[model samples]
Each structure stands twice: as C-alpha cells, then as structure tokens.
Target chain A: MLPELLQGVDTGGLLVIQDSASYSGRHLLQSFINAALNREEAVHVLGFEVSEEELKDGLRGSPVQRLHFHNAYTDPLGWTDHPAFTVHQFCLGELTRLVKQTSHSKPATLVIDSLSWILRHVSTPDVCRTLQQLRKGGAVRSIIGLLHADMHQRGTVGSVCHSATSVITVEPAMRGDEAVAKITKRSKSGKVIQDEEIFRIKDDLTVVVQSKSSKGAKKADSEEQETDPTANLTFNLRLSDTEREAKQKLALPFVFSKEKKTALLHSGPGSGRIHYEPDANDDYDQEDPDDDLDV
Target chain B: MYTELNSILNTTPDSFTQGEFVLLSDRQSDASFLIHHFLSLYLRARCKVCFVGLVQSFNHYSAISQRLGVSLTQAKEKGQLVFLEGQKESLSVLIPQENDTGSQAMDFLRDPSVGLKNLYEFVRSAVSSNGEEGGDGSEEWGPPVLLVDDLSVLLSLGVSAGAVLDFSHYCRAIVCSQLQGNVVMLVRCDGEGEEDEGDDEGSERLMKGLTHQCSLTLHVQGLPTGYCRDIHGQVEVCWRRRQGDGQYTQKKLFQYKVHDKGASFFAPGTSSAVL
Candidate 1:
C-alpha cells in the first residue's frame, strides 16, 4: 500500500501512489471501475504506464470493457491530433458532463483514479464542492474518487476528507515473510442505504486467515493437567521464590511553582485548558432570545 | 427439466406456450456466457435462446443456434425466442425490421399495446404453423428467460439510472401483479469497484418504493481476494401489507454466489432449477 498510513481517511477522492511495478496498483484501479459498473465488467483505469496488451491479458475472460479518458502527460501523439482538448480536460469534462446528464431516479456509479492529480489541475476546493453539488444533482449513477495516501499532508486532502460519504483503506501487513491483508474502514460515518449492512455484520470482522507457513510460529507449552474441574483429586502448584531488596530513590515533583504558572499563562490556552473542564452547557440553556445585540 | 420450465413459464404441457421474459446484465464474460448458455439450453426446445455480443456480429446468434442444433425457426415459431446485443444507442436507434419482429422497437415498448399483441400473434403463428408438423411441437421452450449481456452499457451510454431501475421495478410489479411469472434482473459487480456509494443511494430510493412493487430484492458482490474465489452473498427480502402498520421485515437468504457466473438468487451455478 503506497498510502499505508491512510488506512481510514476518505478525503472524498482517492489518491493512489504505488511502486508502479506492483500489479496491485493496477488491480486496485481496475477494482474501482469494476465497483462502479456494479462489477458487471472488469474495467480498469489506464495508468501512465499501462499498455493495451497488459489490459487485454489481465482482463482475459472478463466481460468488462475499457472507456479510455484522454491523458495529456501521456499519449501526446493522439492528444493534439485526435481531439481539440487535452486528456485531463476531456476526462473532467466527460465526468462533469456525465454528472450533469445522469438522472436522479436510477443509480449511477462513477469511479475516477488519482484525485490528487485532478485537484492539482483544478483547485481542490472546487473539486470538493463540485462533488457535493454533483451528488446532490443526481446526474451521477455513482461517484468514487481514488487518491494517493501521500497527498494527505497537503491542505486540500483534509478538506476533501470532511465531505466524503465513505472511505476505505487497503494496505499490506507483513510480519517476516508472512503477509496479512488488512481492510480498514474510514467511511463508517457514511450512512448505510443498502444490503451492505448484512455483509458487513457477518463478514467485516478480521478473520484469523492463516497462511501455510510455520517459520515464525510461536508455540505455547503451558498445560495444567486437570482433566475435569470437579473430578480432580489432587493439584500441584509451583511457587517461585522471589527476592525483594529495599531501595530508596528521590521522587519527582509533579507540581509546578508560581514561576511555572506564570510561564503557563504566557504559554497558551492548550496547556491551560487541559487543567480544567468548563461547563459547555452553562450559558446554553440560560440564553434568552430577547438578549440585546450589538447591532 | 423441460417440464419444470414449462410449468414456470405458465404454458400448458400439450398446448403451445410462450416463454417468460428475463433480463440478465453484467460485465463478467464467463458469467454472461454461462448465463446465456444455461438459459439457451433450458429454453432450447421450448423457447428460442441466443446470446448477443456487443461487438460480435448478429450472425453469431444464428451460428450459436446452429451449433446447439436447436432449430431457431422452431423456437421463433413458438414465440419463445429472443436475442439482444450489448450495444448502447439512442432510443431512436434503428432496430432491424424482420418478419419475425413486428414492432419490438422503442416506440412499441413505450406503448406496449400493438407490440405485445403483435408479439403474441407472432408466437401463436410460429407455434401453430410449425409445431403441428413435428411430434415435438408439444415441447415447451426450455423456460422463458431474458438475458441482458451487460447492464453497464445502459449506465455508460448515459441511460438514466432512474429509468433503468424503474424498468426493473416495473418488471417486478408486473410479475407480482400477474403472480404467475417470475422476472429476474441480473446485475454483476465483479470486484471492489463494483460497490459504489451511489449505487447504495439508488438502491435506497428503489427500496423506498419496492415495499409495494416487489416481493424480493437480492444484492451480490464478487470478491477477488479471498480463499473462496467468490464471496458468499446475502439476499434481503422486504414485503408490504395492504393494512396495519405496513412495516417491512427483512430476511437474509444465505449461500448466494458472487463471481464470474454472475450473481442471482434465481439460479445456483449451472442448475436451471431455482433453489
């Protein structure tokens, strides 16, 4: 998982950054498209390095078809000659157009790869607000944005996170040579509107999926030879002879003097607020609607 | 097997009976092919069955029918035959006019009167004319089945999701109203990408209306990253009452499959029998 730390963050859109060589990234991209089409097709997004042959070979025996959106950084040969606009512009235009055209009655699913780049070109805030509007507009069958994890440090990622319906984090966990697949939920706050709640309840918990490996296995050998709880005639217990030595050490003082208090006042509210619990509801109930205003 | 299909299709054992209509959609090639094959075989002698490819030639239909050694003419005569390609086009796209197809175009679907009558007539003529010639005319089309090759085509072509869902809901309403025939809408979501927040929203909207419109609604998802190639799915059924609180109750149907075979509660694996 290139964005390992982004285990539970849904910055609305996705940010996918992988080693490029790992086919996992490619598979992940394909999964997004597949999810959008309701898994009717094995459609996957074309990456900067993806090839037609690879797509065909990988999607062998799958029903999904590819709908390639234009890319500017790549495919320059076809960029200027084929269409009047660039690839990114075309993709966003098509996406936005799709959102505008779709109906609210039926469901639509939209899957886009790399929101980070999309935002870099268009302002992040615009993308955020546009997504919100599109969702409300009901023109989208569905909308899913993919982003790389590293982009979270950027200010825009935080803004996007606050607006998403749900967020899912996929990452790799390794202990020695063994690997564990961990799926973390970031979109728990998103409302459940379908049959997914049943599946989540029955199957969402992490299972102890054991791999066929024993190199790093640790065995527990403690056994108390009691066959039946009440039938036991005798019991043997081991008592360890432990020794204690008296020792004296200076105790650290937790309290600060007046000088420290003065420094704390100057330090800031963060430290000062930690020392007390203010009544948040104190004036909330007592406030009168007729109270005078500065206006 | 043919007996069961005949019974479900609501056709008399001896009299020529038309097949029921079913719609199956998904992008899993193997799944789409399997569904097509199963429906074709089941509806073979009793009904005409053909899997239409989006990019593949319509002639492929004839070829498939020939290879199966099932007489397409016989199927057509019985009003139990149908084939559809996966191409996405406008409502006005020119549908080829053939003697067999009287008015199955978009206009006909919207109005349904002339087209449905014409369809019934075509079936009657096909069955009465050819079914009498052979001793096998009494054979029922395997089962009435409609297969939608890919549902995403409707979505990608900019078809209103609401419209597609409405059609599905409409089919269910009609089926329930008739109470004799069954309509199955097959939607295949292959992997992780198949599940979208938007689909959930749409499903919620459908559910709001489904209380009175449908007897059952099943959702399935395929998993590519597990010990089991396909994850076991759950089917939730909700029903509405004519009186009382009209509150809905949900029950999960276990052991559903989500994979290349396409997800459905109507059929399990290659078996035509619904369990």
Candidate 2:
C-alpha cells in the first residue's frame, strides 16, 4: 500500500509494526520515519534492539537534524554508568516528556524501535496499558512499535495486537525475492482494511510499494515469456484469418455424410450385389490351404 | 562434490551473500550432512567461521571436515575457525567444578532470564574478525559465518521455545544485521499440525517459526517407500532470495545417497533406478 493506505499522516493512533525472524520490518519503519519527517513531525526513536551508530548509519544521507535518537541500546539495563535512557524508562510519561520537551504543540511520532524487547521484560497488560494511554490522549501523532511475533507467546502477541490501531506484518512475498507488508488498518470509524503489498526501501529511504495486481501482472508476463512456443521463431507458424476459415471448410477423403447415407439406402437402382471377375492366375486360397501346409 | 547441490541451490562461494539466514531441517532422515556441507563451504570461502556444535563433539566434526578435505585444526590454529562443543560445555555447566571460572559458554543454564544470551554472545565474540572491520572485537578475519549444528538440544534442555527463538533473533541482529554476516540454524521437527507429537511441540514451533524467517530452507526427509539400498532420503530446497528482480521462491526436490566421504543428489527415482 502507498502512503494513505499505510496511514502515514493521520490522527494519533498506535501503529504496531509486527515482524518475525524471517522478514524484517526495519525498512518499513524507516519508510514510516520518512513519512513523519515529510510532515516535519519531530521524530523520537527508542532504540533498544540496535545501537545508535547502526541507526545513524542506516539513515546516512538523509537529513537527521529533526531526528532525536534515544540510546537504549548501549545500556538498556544499566550494565554500566552510560548516560542513556534505560528500557525501564519506557513508559508513557517518559515518552511524552521527551516528545513535549523536544517539540512544540505539534504532535510528534514515538517509535519504540521494537515492542518485543519491552514485552519480554514488561508484563503484557502493562505494555498494552501504556499503548492505550499513548493513543487515547497525548501529543503523540502515531506510535509505532516493532513486535517480533515468534519471540512471544501466541496469547501475548494477540493481546498486543488487540491494542494496535494498525498492525503491519512483514512477511516474504509468495512470488518473488520481495517482502510483503500485510497491513490491517483500523480507521477512526472502526473500518478495517486489509491489504498485502510488495514493498522495497529505496536507497533514499522511500518505500516503493508494488500492489498485488502489478505483481500478478509481472508474474503473468514472465510466464508468457516462457510458455509461448510461437514466440521468437524463424518461420511464421501462425495462420491468417482467411486461411483458418478455409481449413475449417475443407473436407477430407472420408465420404460419410447424412445425404450420402440416405441416397445409398433409398436411391439405389436395384438390390445391392457384389460382382467379382476372377482371373486364371488369381487363386482364392481358403483356410484349408493353410491348414495343409501347417500339418 | 557439492556441484549438484550448488547448482540446485544456485549458490556459489562468490555469490553467497552476507546477512543471509539459512535453515536446515529434517523430519525422517538425517540432515547433518547438509551442515557438514556448509562447514566445508564456509571454510573454503575463507570466511571466519563459528560452529556451535550441539549434537556432536568437536572431534566428530573435525573428522567429517577432514573427509571434506578441510582441516579444522589448521583453521583453528590460523584463528579462522571457532568451535564450541555443546556436549562438553553442557557437561561442564551441569556438573560444576571447583574454581572453574573460565567457561561461561553455558551461563544461560543458571540464568534463564538471560536465556541464550551468554551462548549468543559467545558466538558473537568467538568469531571476531582479524584485520577487517571489527564488530564485537578487533582480531583479524573476513566475513563471519555462524553455524549451529542444531537448536533442538536447547529446547530439550528445558529452555522455552520463545527463548530459543530469541537466541536466534539476537544472533541475527549481531551476525547478520550489524556485522553483515550469515547465520545458519538447524532444527529437528518430527511432525506438524494434526500428526503433532505431544512432546516435540517446542521443536515443531521453533522449526515452523524458523521456516517463515529463513532466506533458504532445506527440508530433508526419508523416502516415502521406506529405506532402500541405493537411496537414503530426499531434500527439498526452498530458495527465498528476497530482494532481486527474480524474487519468487524456487522449490525443488532431489534424492540423496550418503557415502563415507560425501553425498550425491539426483532426481527422485532416478538415483535408485539408475545407480
């Protein structure tokens, strides 16, 4: 899906980017970052799963001035005296305080680099409570959290998904070497739109979404390339319209038709008889001739 | 030779991309041969290798690698290979010795909260690069390749399936994402869904979860007509190379016969009927 279908710049809600071990949602999250930056919404990243250097390296050529990255990766649990935000401080108040102190009244985007890490340490109800509070009332425009589906219990992942306004699941596309974002967007009127689109993160960090129909057309094009025997031949194997009509009209040597059958049954001159003239050299040998030779 | 498999997989040493995740699994027959094949492949590619051998000892792998014409000892001496014997480490972790503070490989045994963090960290630190850009250390090496013999042993050790999956996730972040290396995990799954074994649920969940995430999956299973003198089993290779113009998965099945030195792959029924 493109920007509008992705709920890029809409009213405040929780957008959960759920991923698995196979297809990563990092690039899609980057696309979301671009969307927020396009609107000039202040960006705050809570990166617990990755280092700041890696995050900076990912957005190398992009303008990162408005981007405020919180370093929870260096020491999420306070292993050393590193001056950074710990995973324990991943609460609604802390996030709101960070967003309010950094930007003006314009709603800012809050990204929890991943929700799986918090779900592991924090209780399911607690995380869901924070998600609800952040979405219902705050300066938060859209809260995006990356949740790894395989790392949590089914019931746990389900409960977290229940608290989300949009759940974009990253999965490998069925056709090609591309990844699909299965987005389940719940709009303000409580309408849910489920769509699967093949997406690529451009070098400039823009999401190039390939719709389902175009992907199917591309597949059909490839199959058309392989299966058509008439394609790229030395001789003209196809027939013209008139030639095909003439071929359809031409009858073979078999003289069996309804008129012929009726004429033979009724219009014969007399009784049908077989007349044979046997020559002197033409000797008709019966079964007895072969029987004598066998004995 | 791996020419047949290489052609089937469409992978060569030069084209083997960094940051790829490979999964090897078997339902009926053994798939350890594939792991051995990858070990030989990585060693020949001149990449720094870390092998977390949980199913067998180091000597067993050393012997297998020798048959494949690659010496693990020489690679180890050159600091190009790191081998962690899970059997030995599990033993050491199970039965503590007096003042044996050296081996922290199985520290997850005592600390379930950290899960396989210590083991994952060991893999991350052990295969530290030599002269190249260091990820977690500053030694000397080329691209890092982490190969786990199998992950089911961790499940059998009472570690939760989620924990085992988290271990792989962390490994992917460090080995594949940060370091731009490759991670290969082998898991054993018996049956799925309706025919699910009551106790093998963890391994099954782990395998199913992994299959969804793997860039390439080789599912090895025994022959349907039972064991034959000529054929051992079949391997179904599913290649999901996710970012090229040719993005679809190519799945093909081939039968294999395991000899002492190496194995041979052929189309189904051809190997037994012809050979």
TM-score of chain A of each: 0.45, 0.72
Scoring each candidate complex against the real one, what DockQ results? 0.01, 0.17
**Residue B99 displacement in candidate 1 (angstroms):** 14
Per-prediction TM-score, chain B alone: 0.45, 0.90
Best DockQ among the predictions, by candidate number:
2
Candidate 2 per-residue C-alpha lDDT over B15-113 given as tens digits, one digit per residue, 9 for 90 to 100? 677777899999866899999999988888888999999899899999989998999999887778888988888778889878776568787776665
- After TM-score superposition, the amount by which residue A76's alpha carbon in candidate 2 deviates from its true location, in angstroms, is 5.7
Instruction: Summarize candidate 1's per-residue lDDT along B140-171 as a digit string, tens digits.
Output: 43333333344334444444434444344333
Looking at model 2, residue B155 earns an lDDT score of 81
- Which run of 10 residues does model 1 chain B get worst, by summed lDDT? B239-248
